[model samples]
Target: MAPSIRLSPAARSLFDEPLAIAVQGLGPRQQVTLRTSLRDETGELFQASARYQAGDDGRLDLARCPALPGGSFSGLEPMGLLWALQPQKPFWRLVKRDVQSPFLLQLEVFEGHGERPGRLLAQAQHERAFLRDGVRRVPVREGRIRATLFLPPGEDTFPGIIDIHGFGGGLLEARASLLANHGFATLALAYYQFEDLPQKPKELHLEYFEEAVNYMLQHPQVKGPGVGLLGFSKGAEVSLAMAAFLKNIMAVASLNAPVAATCIPFSYKDKIIPAATSYEHKAKTTSSKFLDYSDVLDDPFQAPGNQSLIPLEKAEAQFLFIVGQDDHVVKSEYYATEVCKLMQAQGKGNFQILSYPGTGHCIDPPFFPLYPIGSHPVFHKRAVLGGELRAYSKAQVHAWSQVQAFFKKYL
Candidate 1:
């Protein structure tokens, strides 16, 4: 019989769930290469492979067998094929533009561990989904707000939350869709770079975001006297500002964001917060040829730059700051530490910081590939997004839960 790959429980599962992989009908003690590949909406291919040996019983269980050295990874990571995937195109990130469709994952078994696979022995495919059955994808276009609202399968109104993606924004619904499946009414809000929105706005206005917040509070399906805010990078910075200046923000989960306004100024009625820092001068070229943006922003605690700091002390909401210690895109640990210090000094302990060592920027859901490096989507320049593969993957998983729990508690 030909060696066959078996994916247990279900071939179709949510992206966050784990699966068991095993090979049957292989020769005893046979060496093989296991490879996995998938393409994104833009046709960018991401792939991963590992060397392995079959057991004496003519079978190989990924959970039991350790992957050999000199492949994408080495060790007994059953989900490594999914987590260790790297893009063939340099600096391209894997983001699901359409949550309605799953990423079709192709898996193959090769006869030997050569630089190139000796021969394809077996193959299989799996579907990694973002949205669960019964989840509703609702497009929201109410009064100057462009967004997508995700509703879990039920007639009940749930705790409401807003999800914001970072710079180079279009409407991103993947994270919001997945969060709704877990029982929250999640809204993926777009600030710019979409239908009718400006390509480059000189300043981002908080009044615009406040419109989104008010929409969530007024949503019939969104149970709220207040709503929760979840954001990453520039999005997180915006979330921080909303929590500080806006009402009806019950909680905030910020991922690798700055405490000071960055790149662009922020304005509210009668007030304007000037830009704090930029990538100029500080965005240095690394030895590896990739740009390291870790020091691009000016010091937020010092003269002039300190003026741009978000007055987070004024926020009444509970806060969760998720910091990636090894992030090369920003000084996440430093920013988070200073925020905590400032909060404590103000006699406010409404915040908690979770620092993940060896984790980098671009933290997403579990089982997604390691985005240790990428170019700025807007800037279109190469960047060294620091993180160990295993550590980054683990941090993504843990931080996701922490965000959910924090929201569930306060919202």
Candidate 2:
């Protein structure tokens, strides 16, 4: 009998790997009957399997084995039995498979984990929308890109919003979805996934975003010749950059996004720009990645001084900066102060900033619980784990209402 098999570290990292039972010390033409049983974390027997034959190589193929509940058996590569299990949820066990054998074989167990954080973060980045309502997709640039057209229920063309998503996250979020439901033509633009990934941050491409804005303005559903730009996190930074460089943009709203220029390597019209702007301590949690710009005004790689990239002073459109005071991911205070200063310097009056106290990053709309508060990587800078589940405050609601009013008048 072969020793019990276990998962290797590399295999474990892949998110999905099967559990197996190996049989050895057999001769050709020797038939070996095995009996197996599988159980979940509750210690209940979920599966019972019976037989297998020894191959010419003195190895038994147990591929096609019965799967326990919530588990699937496969004969695919890494040729072994597989069980689908969730660790955060429960545990499962596989029992003996050999018959007429005195030895009791115990298959090692593995659990299924919940969705990846990166995936969840991406999903949370976009608001959900119904197919029959609000917005529709139109092909652009030979279908290389798509233009989303948001239309109000009434025949009247409403103001348009060009939505941009954060870094490493794609379109399809609650922000745009809800905005479209509320009568705004929201175009969630995909600058990266619509085409190839850019080579670096300085080299990052904005041509697609620019085209998307043009497309929105030309759409019949749009009420005006231009549209507003609403961005979150990296998207917010992009919004700022676009407003700085693009003349057609009419308004901008930056939500809980970093004010610093990004550091992804990309080519901007054949120029090689280093990716050194966005920095995060991988060893730390999201809240622990809190950024402060007070010290780096002179550093080009830091915030504050990067203002040349964003003409906050020359912005012609109305601007709203929405941030959470307790947000650790991006220093809301730093961005608020810097943007206010820029607006003041430029004599720009059509701008406002609102901050929600006791709120963390990624403030959901009062449905979900407030997370990462007092944990290891707290953004609030306090050790208050599980601080209350304050998803949205009255102040946030008022601020949102104000946003709608502002856009209604400006967009």
Candidate 3:
């Protein structure tokens, strides 16, 4: 027989009052039972019992007794469950029933402070762009590309949109899919598989995206004349650089993206360009080295260095800069200000800039669960405000509408 485990006084206080639990671990293929008792400041409030079964593989199976006050303890869903777990908070506990191998067990005292029913209003919104059909894949350059082309469902030809995903993440994300649902012929290009890790930015190539754009223009569903470019984070920077250097791009929208250059070295024609920039800019200030990526590689279009390497002044496409005020990830306002300054200096007035307050880096459409609010893991010193995923604000929705209108007028 193994020893039983109990909850600490501090841990019990988190459950709204005081709670006690006794857990025993059975050997593999055996089962152990648990009894949970709860009390308020006054006295006993409720009592419950649960059963735990030990599988042959040493995994403990937890089942709640139906007679318990909370009914059952079903686990959380996959994607939405991220908000349910507390990051960097000691909100969970583990109890062991065995001494040697110590059969492990985890318990969460649910006082209902997390994202569960009766908490926040988080819903998923569904909208489709192509009135007639769903997404289809097209073969291009010996490889297949997944794309969603949306027309007005009439005989009219509409402007096209090519959406690029950010670093490491995949194309199946809500951002690209939602844009396609909104009547844009969106091509969510998967630079890397979600299951497969991506190489560092320095190893990326610009020719692949150029090839993607060319393929989109050749598609029967896409409007042949030109197409708009939309990207977030690293993808946004790529879109901006492509618009600057590529002749076919008609418009670009960059969202909360870093303008730093990459580290890969490549030759555009015969000239070698550096990979990324070396500048160290605070949230609102830019150093002279900010655009200098020439030291690393000759191809400035690769990553960090692409900021100053691509000549936006020579770009023919209209641009839109969308940023969140509370975006500590990339310092949205700083990029917006710098880009606007450069555009103005080049006598380019065909660009628009919009910002939203109380919003974090990923301004997902309304209904998605918001990120957990706190300092970012990458930039631990900086504050990150995470909460229920925010949908496009009325103002943001209006801005998106304007973006569509702008592309329609230009592209």
Candidate 4:
């Protein structure tokens, strides 16, 4: 038989899983160049290639063979091509898409690693599924909340969720879009920095969120006497407050969120929750580009006019707090601990926390690189967001499943 390429599961896979590659019908020790390419959100193609030699049996299986030199990755790691692929520049990263779309991994084989005249050997492609098929996204412009609703395909009512983003300040559709693919009707809602919303985090009102809840509840495809809330960072606090003060919020999943109201003052009809006061630690930044926030994490209750603690005693929603122990952004693990203590003291039994020791602040969907530090998008200051690569990746998969199961039971 002529040389050909084959995939273990055959041309389809989940984004979280790996695909096995094999080349067959080559002469023993013959050099073969393997290449793969995937496009990003902006339509830029990110490519990676490697050279390998067929074994004594006239075949090379990625499962049994190692990557050889002369391509993008010069290491001996198996599956190195999947993670080590680079953009045109060293500083640029592979693009990650959060929309409901399948990423195509186009693969090709060449006789050798030739710059211009390499003879083609074999070709194949695999479809990696992330978002589920038939998921529909509708732009939300109703009321004060500017958002987008991702409704899974089908006429049957699905559990509804309102997804809120952090201090970065725009309507992020990724998380909500992915959730919709997992069988939930999700709304990625924005409080600021897009369209007519607030330019910054100021004068936040719970009523705007209430309007969002109403919108989700009124959707014909949403089955809800109540809905779920999913939020990150600053948005996590909003989710907490909504679950505490608003009616019909049955569940909430908060990722790297603070137990105390922090960053911005939160106001309801006649009351205001003071934000926790923060101060930068100048001494810790001498060795690294990211500033350490260890000093500002001092007990918020000790701060003057500190009224940021949400009234958890009033919340009826079931809660799942996902925190990273090494998160340097807002001391998520510490805040999660404090919140758990408060809930225990108040005799609340519907709350639980899943803390990953080595993860970071941005526990996004799986397969994204571990961003150790970056300039805060809104604040424009370099700061640490801690995580070891493998640990953070594991946290993402676990948390994604946990969110679905939690909402399935409570929403």
Highest-lDDT candidate: 1
The TM-score leader among the candidates is: 1
TM-scores, in order shown?
0.96, 0.56, 0.55, 0.83
Give a tens-digit lDDT track for model 1, residues 255-342: 9998888887899998888888575667788888888878777778766447799999999999999989988877888998988898
Global lDDT of model 1: 0.88
Q: 315-375 in candidate 4: lDDT tens per residue?
A: 9999999999888777777777777787888888888999997887777766554566765
> Candidate 3, 291: how far from true, in Å?
25
- Note the Cα lDDT for every prediction shown: 0.88, 0.49, 0.48, 0.78
Q: Give the poorly placed runs of model 1, Cα more than 4 Å off.
A: 377-379
> What is the lDDT, from 0 to 100, of the residue 19 in candidate 4?
72
lDDT of 3 by residue, 1-411 (tens): 543343433121211111233233334544333333322223322222233344565333232211122322223211111112221222111111111121112332222222342222111111111122343333233244443333334444546787776544444434444454455666656665533435344444566667778877876767768789888766787787777667689888877765543434333444444545433333231142112111222323334435345457778888888787666456556767776776798788878888766555664433232343433323333333322232323334455566667677777
- Which runs in model 2 stand beyond 4 Å of their true positions? 1-144, 194-202, 265-309, 365-388, 391-396
* Model 3 CA deviation exceeding 4 Å by range: 1-156, 193-201, 262-267, 270-309, 372-396
Single out the weakest 10-residue window by summed lDDT for candidate 2: 117-126
Question: After best superposition, candidate 1 residue 327: deviation in angstroms?
Answer: 1.6
Give the candidates in order of TM-score, highest first.
Answer: 1, 4, 2, 3
Compute the lDDT of residue 357 as modeled in candidate 2.
68
Question: Which lDDT tens digits does candidate 2 get at residues 89-200?
Answer: 1222122221111111233322122221111100001111133242443434523455445455766787889877765533444455456666787776666544553422
lDDT against true structure, model 4: 0.78
Q: Least accurate stretch of 10 residues (summed lDDT) in model 3?
A: 95-104
lDDT of 1 at 194: 91
